[model samples]
Structure formats: C-alpha cells, structure tokens
Target chain A: MPVRLFLALLAMFVTGEAAGQVRAIEVLGPRPFGYFIGDVIRLQVDVVLDEPFTLQAGSLPRPRPVTYWLDLKTVAVDDRGINGGLHRYRLALDYQIFYAPLEPRELAIPGFSVTATDGAHRVEANVPAWSFLMSPLREIMPRGTGDPVYLRNDTGPMILPVRRWLSLAIASGIASVLLLGLLAYNRAWWPFSTRRKRPFVQAVRAARRAFRSGSGAEAYRAGLLCLHRAFDATAGRAVLADDLSSFLKTAPAFRPLEPEIGRFFQASRRAFFGADARGAEADLPRTVLIDLGARLAEAERGLS
Target chain B: MVDLSSLFHHSGNRWAGVPLLSVERLKSILLVNTLVVAFAAFTVSGWLAFSAWNDNRVISGLATGRDIAVGDRARPEILLARGQFLMRRGRLDEAQALVPAVRISGDRRVLAAIQYDLANARLRTALRLIEDMKIDQAIPLINLAKDGYRAALSVRPDLWDARYNLDVAMRLVRDFPEIQPSSEEPPQETPEKLWTDLPGLPKGLP
Candidate 1:
C-alpha cells in the first residue's frame, strides 16, 4: 500500500511541474560554422502557448548583448494573426571571435527567461542554451611554416584620449597670457616700470604747479615761460612766432595744437616784451591757457 | 575697407596714428582673458572627472566578479580585467572561461588579453618543467609562447607591450634548435593557444 501511494504521489508531482510550463520554447542555432570576429549570426525561437495565455509586449527578453562578443542586434516577434498559439521570435546577433583556435571549436550562447502574461498570474518559461562551432582561420598544424600561432598575451589598461583636450588647454593658456601682457603694457598703472614721459605732459604738469598761489601777473609770466620751454624742447630749437610753420613740419603729432601754438606765441609776445602787460592777460585768459596745456597733453598720450 | 589709405595721408599719419580713443580698454582684455582661462579649465577638468568616473566603473566591476554574480552582466571592460587577473594568478580555467566573450569583442585590447594569457601559460609550463628537473622540456613551450607573441605583434605593430613580451620570450628560449626545422615531422602537439586552457601534456616527447 505504501509503495502504491509513493508512486501515485511521484506521478502527480511530475505532472504538475510539466503542466506549469504552458508554453513550449524551442531555440535554434547560433549558426553551425564559418564564423569569425566581427560577424553577425541569426537565431530562431518558437514559443507555443496554451489557450488561456496570449503573447503581448514585455513577454520577451529585453534586447541586449548576451555577452561581449554576442550582441542581440535585432528582435522581431510575430504573432500568427489568427492566434493559432504559434509565437515566433527571430534574433540577430553580431559577434567577433578573438580566439584564433587551431581547430574548429564550439562556443555557447547563454539563454534567458521569457514571461507570458495572463489576467493576473504570469507564467514563466526557460529557453535552453544553445551553441555552435567557430571554425579556425588556419590549419591546426601547418606543414612547413616556421612561424606558427601561439597563445595570446595579456592587455594593458585603457589610456584616455587626452590629446584634444590638452591641445585646447594649451592654446587657451597662451591666449590668456598675451591678453594679460597687452593690458599691462597699455596701463602705466604699475608705477615701477620706467616709461618715457611725453614733453607736453611734463609741461602741462609744470604749468599747473606754477600757478598754485602767487600774484596773478607773476603767475601769468611763469605760465608763459613754461609754454615756451615746452615748444623749444619739442622742436629741439627755439620756436619763435615766425617758426610755427617749421614746428608743425617737425612734429606732426602736435598738428591739432596749431591754433593753440599760435595763441601762446601771441600771448608770449605781449607778456614779456610788449608795452602793455594788461593786453596779454586779456588776450589769453589764465583759465584758457591752462586748459590749452591740458588738451595738448591728452593728444600726446593718444599718440601711437 | 574704409579706404584707410586716406587716413594715412592725413598729416603724415602722426596725429591720426593716435587712435581716436586713448587708453587700451582694460575691460575688453580682462573679459577675453577670463574667458580663455575658463575654457582651459573646463576641458582639462572635464577629462579628469571622466577618468575618475571610468575608474569607479572598473572598481564596481571588480566587486561584481569577486561576488561571483554568475548571471550579472559585468561590463566588457571589467570582464577583460578580471580575466587578466585570473590568468596572472595561474587560474587558467577561470581565465579561459571568459575567453569566448572577450574574444568576440575583438580589437587591440584582445591583443592585450592574448599577451597576458600567453605569458601566464609560459609561466605555468616553465614552473612545471622546473618541478620535474627537466630544463630541456621547457624550451619548446617557451619558444611556442614567443611565437604566439610574434603572431600577436604581426596583427598589431603598435603594441610596444607585445614587443616587450616578445623580447622576454626570446630571452627565455635563448637559442632555437638548429636540427629540428629541416626534419619533416611536425611536433605532435600544437603551440600554446590564446583561447582554450588545455591541461599540460605529460613529459618525454620531443
């Protein structure tokens, strides 16, 4: 009685396990031969489900590279349209075999799980693993060749391509340095560096200091002397009223100051040697004379 | 093209030489200079950050292999590294197990994996020969490994590493057997291969 009960129980367990796999899964080749590195292979899968289950989205394995060499390139699933329970999935794989095998050898392709969706309960089925031969490029033992194939050696770590970035960084670094130099050269802001002072700039500063606090008439004389000294130093010759034309020829940088030079010469003639000193003050106001000196200094600084 | 020739004619270009605006505008220089510096920093720093991220991925991959997460999809880069590690430690079985996947993604890196496997394989044979006190038995194995390195070099000349290992191999089996090449008989065993990790054969054959 015990033996009969055990046999009955074993049969029931086996039947239950078989019944749970409501769908059938059949996996075809990774293609039998003539494969090498960087080649693509095709595999066909057939899944037949029972009456209650229907194939739908997410029912198949997600398309991804099964292994580094074997990539799942494309996945196309077809439903028989009439719902005859024959579901077909065609998988395309791109592979590259680095092994230069001396003889024809087999390589395995790992299989994955497929899920079939019902109203609430999901039935799962396993797609058995499959393999195929990878044919060698050359003979296992070449007859006469002195150079024969040997084992592949280890590889080094990957070195990042930093050439592009390094070049850009170097270029930008140079540009910034040049720009900084231009800024420093233009501005006399850093006083330690020696720079030639324009003659007109020096004269303008001297004139401003000459009239600080004194008799208006004496200050007037001092300012006139200051203007005469600037013109003589700039021309490298005494610049009398008659020599104004020659002065303009020698230093075209002061061409804009032609009118101002004429005025200063007239004021000089009246202030030092004229019978009436009052006329000198009226001809060139103290304020106008100082402003003329300032304008000339600005033009000098603008000189390239 | 404002016919700048006319401007040059004005008063021998002395007054005109002075740009209408004096004082180099420091604002523009500073702005442009700042922009250059920023761009430089962005490129260099970006690469550094990327390198760090790559290193992290490799670290995570090592952990994944150590855990022996069989079905877990380790990145190809990580798998290559782990395979190399196993080979170096003389765990040829574990190393060869990853060969199919590594070999499939063939490139120069594959040459590297091949190089590692060959060196380790030679080391295994050399150690075995030493244990048996048979120095002569190791010569062909070393020569075969050198030939493998040479074949790898022929595939890629840019591998200085392959060149170095080839040199190492050449030094190991210092002189070739002068008498063997003329003979018609091919060695019964093929040379060491980069792919399968076959067990070493018993000694006593030429």
Candidate 2:
C-alpha cells in the first residue's frame, strides 16, 4: 500500500511538469576559461516549445552593457519553425569582456526570463546564468622596470589611394588627345591643309574661273591645260594622250569616264597640235569642258 | 553626236553597275561621329583628372599639419583628416562633433581611426585631470573615451591600440550599477553611501 501511494504521487508530479507549453531551454557557448580583457564571448541559446506556442520577441534581451566590465554587443534571434511538433528559437548573443583582472576570476552573466504565448495561453522559460573565468592581460607587479604601465601606440591617419584616380585621368586624357589628332587629320586642318587628296576638285575650280574670264581661244586653252594638269596629278606623273589605256587600266575607278576623257584629248590635239582652235571649240564647247571637269571631280571623290 | 548629258548620267550609276554613297560623304560622316566621341572622352578625362588633383592637394595639406577649410560636402577622407587635426590641436569638442559625419563613411578603417584618435585625445585629457587630483571632473571624460574605444573596436576588432586603451580606462574606473532612488528611503544618505560604494584605487599599483 505504501509503494503504490509513492508511485501515484510521482506520476502526478511528472504529468504536472509536462503540462507546461515550454519544453526545454539549452544554452551553448565557448570554453568557460582563458578569456582576457577585450576578448569577445559568443553564446547561443535555443528554446523549444509546443507547436501552438511562439516565443515573444519583445521579451528577448536588448543589447546593452550587462555589467560594468561586460558589454552585450549584439543579439540576434532566428526562428527555426516547427519540426516534429516542436517550435524552436535560436538566440545569438555577443558580449565583450573589459575586465583587467590581476588574477584569474570567475564572473557570472545574469539570467533572464522569456515568455511564449499562443494568444490565449502564456508560458515562461528561464535562461540559466552563465559563468566564465577571465585571465589577466599583464603581470600583477613589475620588477624594477622603468615604465610600469605601457600602453599600445595609437593608429595614425591613413592617406587615401589617390594614385589610382590620377593614373586613370592621365590615360583618358591621352586617349582624348589622340582622338582629337585623328579628327584634325580627317578635316584637313592645320599642318594637313596642303595635303589635299582631291586634285580633280582644284581642276574644276580652275576651269570654271577660266571659262568665266572670256570665250577667247586663250581662255579655252587655259581651261584645257587645267584639266591636263589634273590628269597628271591623279596619275602621279605626266599622262600623255597615248597613256590613256594604261591610266584606265591602273585606275579602274576612272574607267567610267574613259569615253569623255578620250573626247577631251581629241579636242586638245586639234587645238594645240592640229592648230584648228575654232574646230576644236566646235568639237568640245566650253560648257562641255567645264561639265566634264565637274564630273571627273565627282568620280575622283567616289560620288558618281 | 553623242548626247553628253545622257552619257554623264549613265556614268553616274555605271561604276561597277551599282550605286553607292560618295567616298567623301562617308569620310565626312565618320569624322563627325569620331569627333563627338573624342570630345566626350576629353570632357570625362578632364573632370576626373581635376578632381583627383584637388583631392591630392587636400591630402597633402592634411599631412603637413595644415588646417584645411572643410566644406559641408567634404569627402569622408577629408572629414577624417579634419577631425584628426582638431584632436591633435586639443580641440576635443570640435573633433567629437565630426564623429557623426565620419560614422556614415563607407570606409570602416577611416571610421575606426577617427574614433580611436578622438578617444585617445579624451583619455589624455582625463589623465591630466587625474594628475591634478580633479577626480570628479575626469570621470566623465574617461567614460566617454571608453565608449569611443568600444565603438571603434566594434567596427575593427583587430584594433589592438583601441583595445589596450579601453582596458586601461576600465582599470582606472570600474563600472557599477546605477543607484535608483527609493521613495521609502531619505535622499540625504544617498550621496554618502554612493561615495563609499565607489571603488578605491586599483590593487597592486603604487
């Protein structure tokens, strides 16, 4: 009868404990010893609860100076969701210890309670106090030293990396100048003004000016000579009437103008060599000669 | 009796029997496009070079211990330099004012350096006050210095100097819980009890 009563009481106690919503609380951290001044200690706390209950975020500890010698640097919480009918919450806490102990001393991080609620029911879970041993950073006493307390030197201001920007600027400036030079070359600007590539253009201008001067034989001869000069320049040498075929073969770009060129050469021979200037004028009018000059200029520039 | 006009017109499209844009017009179009690009490049290059030059000047001025005029829109590095200069000149308040500006800087190193320097300045001042037996006046400065060191260490944990200084400050004055006034007790004995509760000089120090 006495054994039966004892067993029944123990079962009641176990059932009462299990009836609470919070299931378990576990705290994990680094080794509890060998910490010195300015060392950070990280602790992780995990709380398990029934599926319906959720941890109250507001009840969690806010980062602050926990003690005079210890600073609670950061606190982070992660909800692991529900697994196997248990809801889990993980809390990460970072604390920096600032105690300069003369000898190894034990310190306690105070415990706090957190609440979990499922709208209608509220349950409390306790995080137990943690203790750690802090070691001294330096000797308790110095023996015959000139300087008893020596602090570390301060960090100086650092110079920004300006050389990289300077180099980039220099490279871009060089590229811009080179491009500008290219533009100048294409536009035939200063130092390239005399290197005009369009000789037929100059011939057209000269022939127009001579035709405007008068309709006399002298003016016609001048215009014809201008055209002859243009041909010589284009061929890079004196191109006589007989060299027409070779010039056409070497410069296929002017092959379309072969018939007109041949007519001009015939008219030139009649006037200068055959001494029939009037008949040559009839064969090739001034307007025709001028128009032919313009066409040659256009073809030379690849415009035709 | 060849019709010259017809012949010339035929020749216009007879070059390889395909009409194409004139070479001069193509060359001119290409030249204009290239010129615009080059101009843009030149403008960008000039701007970069000028800014770099200006920044270098400011850096050199700071290195030589010259007081540079800081603008509201000054760069982080410039603000840091100014803060360091003020701290070195014993203007702790002005240097402290620059903290919020430097705190927002993207460069963690610069932020840490400024905090460390400012903390050092405060600690040095507090030490002098302690030498003069003005312990009451020095407590706040030491506390502020400790806070500064902590902030610097948060950003750059490898800052050994800041850590060492913070430890030194801690030993000078240990932190304790703030006393909350109890309505049941008389306020007269509070000051005396607080003074007694304060820790005395550290142990093992002459």
Candidate 3:
C-alpha cells in the first residue's frame, strides 16, 4: 500500500509540472543610477508562458505603497495574444521613490510573483527584484544662511491673457458701429436726413409750416408755390405745367403718380397765374397736396 | 427709349392693378432688416466687451490679494485665484471647496497647479503643527496633503515641486499594509522591522 501511494504522488507531480510552466521572464527599465527623491521609475516585464497557460490578471500588483519610501503609482498589463505557440504578457509598473538619502545609496524594489493558469493547472512566474541608486536633493551640510529645510516656492496663479478676447470685442464693436452707420444712411435718419436731397420731403415740411401759420387763400397760394419749387428742384430746372409728362418720363419711379401730379400743376397754374387760390384749393386740397409731396419723396428715395 | 417706356408701362400697370411692392416699399423693407441686424450686433458686441472688461477687473483685484466676493458662475480663472487667495490666508477648507468647480473647468494645467498649491498649504500647516508638538493633529493633515500631491502628480507627472513635497510628507508618516482577516500568515516584515531596517525616519526638519 505504501509503494502504491508513493507512485501515485510522483505521477501527480509529473502531470502538474507538465500542464503549466513559465517559459521566460524578462525585465526592461531605465538606467538604474543617478535618480533623485520623488522621481518615478518605470519597469517593463515581459512574461512568456507555455502554449495552454494564460496569465491570470487578478494576480497583478495593485497600485499601493510597496515600502515606506516607495509607492507603486500605476500598473498596466498588455496581452500580446499568442505567438510561436506561447502566451505572452507585458506588465508595466510605475514606482515613485520618496527616499531622501544623505548620500548616493542603492535601493532594491521587492520582487513579486504572478500566477498563470490553464483550466485545472496553475503555475507561478517570478519577476526578479530591481535595484537603483538614489541621490540626495541637497548637501548634508548646506551653505545657505537660512533654514536647512528648503522648500520649493509655490507656483502662483497665472494671469489670464485677455488681449485676444479684448481685441475681438473691439473689432466686433467697430463692425457693429459701422453697420449702424450704414443702416442710418439707408434709412435717411437724422444726420443723413439733411444730407440727402429729398426735395419733396422739404417741400411738404415748408407747406405744412405755411398752412400752420396762415389760413384761407394765402395758405393755399403758399402751399402751391412750395410744391412748384420742389418739382423744379427735382427736375433740376423750372418745371411748368406742360413739363409734367417729361418730368415723369425722366423719373419713371414717379409714373405711378401721373394723375395726381397733373392735378397739382393745374392747381399751381390757377393759384399763381390765374390768381384764384380758393379755386386751386378746391381742385386739390391742402391735405392732398401734402400727401402727394410725401409719396414723391418716397419715390425719389427709390430712384437713388 | 424702349427701356424707359417699358419702365413707365410697368409702373402704370402697378398703379392700375395690384399695386405690387414698389421700389420704395422694397427699400423700406431693406432698411428695416438692416436696422434690426445692426441693433442686434451692437447689443451683443457691447455686452461681450463689457463682460470681458469686468472679468479683467476682477482678475486684477485678485492679483493684488483682495478678497473679492465673486458670484457662483464666475470663470475658472477667478475661482482658481480666489482659492489661492484663501489658501494664503490659511482658509484651507474654503480653498478646498473650490476644487470641484475648478476641476469642471477642464483646464488641466490650472487644476494641477491648484492641487499642488493646496497640498503645499496643508503640508506647511502640518509642519507647523508638528513643531508645536501636536503629533496626532498633524498626522491627518499630512495624510491629506500627501493625497493632494498625489492627485496633482497624477494629472501632471512632471510636476517636480509636488513630487518633492510628497516625498517630504511621506517621510513624516510611513504607510503599513492593512491586516487581512482571511490571511492566516503574518506579514513578511513587521512595521517595527521595516522602520528599523532603513533610516526611514526624517532626520532633523523635513
């Protein structure tokens, strides 16, 4: 019974060894010397396993303080899939060493083991420890006159550069003002209102003023004279009753007002030459004359 | 002459028929549209300029170390400046409260700087406490400062000042593994053995 048990145990060990095995473990790192306190050291470990064995990710190291003076800042694993009938994985570990040594001294990063499994069998891949030299930030005996514990100055808040935004605002503001000016010019708003040659508009204003001050024949005669003056100014010459058609032909925009303009000329002739202001007012009332003047002004704006 | 007669005919037809939108009517429409656009542009640009000027003024005041009351919707730069101002005045809690707002700014550089400054302030206070022999009170503050420094380093790995300060804090208090109830074996090296094995203690002042 004892001989049979020994043979069974040997068979079990042989099968276990054959099922899973770590093929290779290789570590790549930076130059291991001349590091200062608080410097991060990174290591790349590549592990190759047997064909059926795969890395168990849970066995990887967690980010934590590995020692009092060293912190495992980060850990990452890259699966290389399968190549050459072997399962491969690359492990990246970042460690921040906080040791402030008085002189250049060597320190060792502790080794750890990761597990690989193939269903029923398990194997361990050992990553060897790494060592590096760390140097002190300052001298043991300082030459400074002040305190020996030298701390770095705080990085102050930066003053945001406002020049770009300010310039943009200024440029847009100028564009807006210029656009306003253009709109004002187009609308004949005051400033531009007086600058534009709106003869009929001025005529309507003068005729209204005359009607406001006077009454009866005098007001009617005055309104007729203002309308005649506006027509002459618009035509750039004296415009008689006979010249109405030619004036309308030259300014086609005013062709829509042909009948009303003809009535105005007939009224003008009666008021000034015929010396019958009441009769002229009867032909075209003061309100009608003023309304015609306003419409002519609007038409004149369209011509320009 | 042909063009003029056709124009006259068109105008006559317009007056006699539907009285279609005249040239004057079209001009009036154009004028109204332009006026609306100009007015809108003027209002918007004026508002932008005014707000930019106001922000600059607030920033200048902050630079001079004045405690200006800022609204909740203040920009990230203003919040960062206020946090720094608070830190300088030893109002650490108020400074720390501004972290979420500053973080939301998405300006990584500013966030890292703020974290580093807050950590520095904490470490300085903790050192003062240690000098006064308040060991228990200083321990928590040092731990907080270490976390702040670590956070800053995570965002910006090249921040040497934060790294140095973190190292200083680390030497003040050592980290030991937490005991797990499931593990039957004791830790490989006890805290006492690890502390004594190397000159881990801070010599003189940190």
The DockQ figures for the candidates are 0.06, 0.25, 0.16
lDDT of 3: 0.79
| Candidate 3: clashing residue pairs, number | 0
True contacts kept of 3: 0.24
Model 1's CAPRI class is incorrect
Instruction: Decide which is better by DockQ, 2 or 3.
Output: 2
- TM-score, structure 1 vs. true: 0.36
lDDT tens readout by residue for model 3, A1-304: 9999999989866864675488789988899899987678999999998778988889999999887677898999999989877888899999987676767999999989999998888888899999888887655544455642455678886666656656665666676677667767877786687555778888998899999988889888888788788888878999997877888888898999898888888888888889988888888988898999999888888766
Best by TM-score: 2
Q: Give lDDT tens digits, candidate 2, residues A142-214.
A: 3455533345666765665656656666665676677667767777777666555777889989888988999
Stretches off by above 4 angstroms in model 3 are A1-19, A168-304, B1-53, B63-65, B69-74, B104-106, B126-144, B166-206
Candidate 3, residue A278: lDDT: 88
Question: What DockQ score does model 2 reach against the true complex?
Answer: 0.25
Position A27, candidate 3: lDDT: 89
What lDDT, from 0 to 1, does candidate 1 have? 0.60
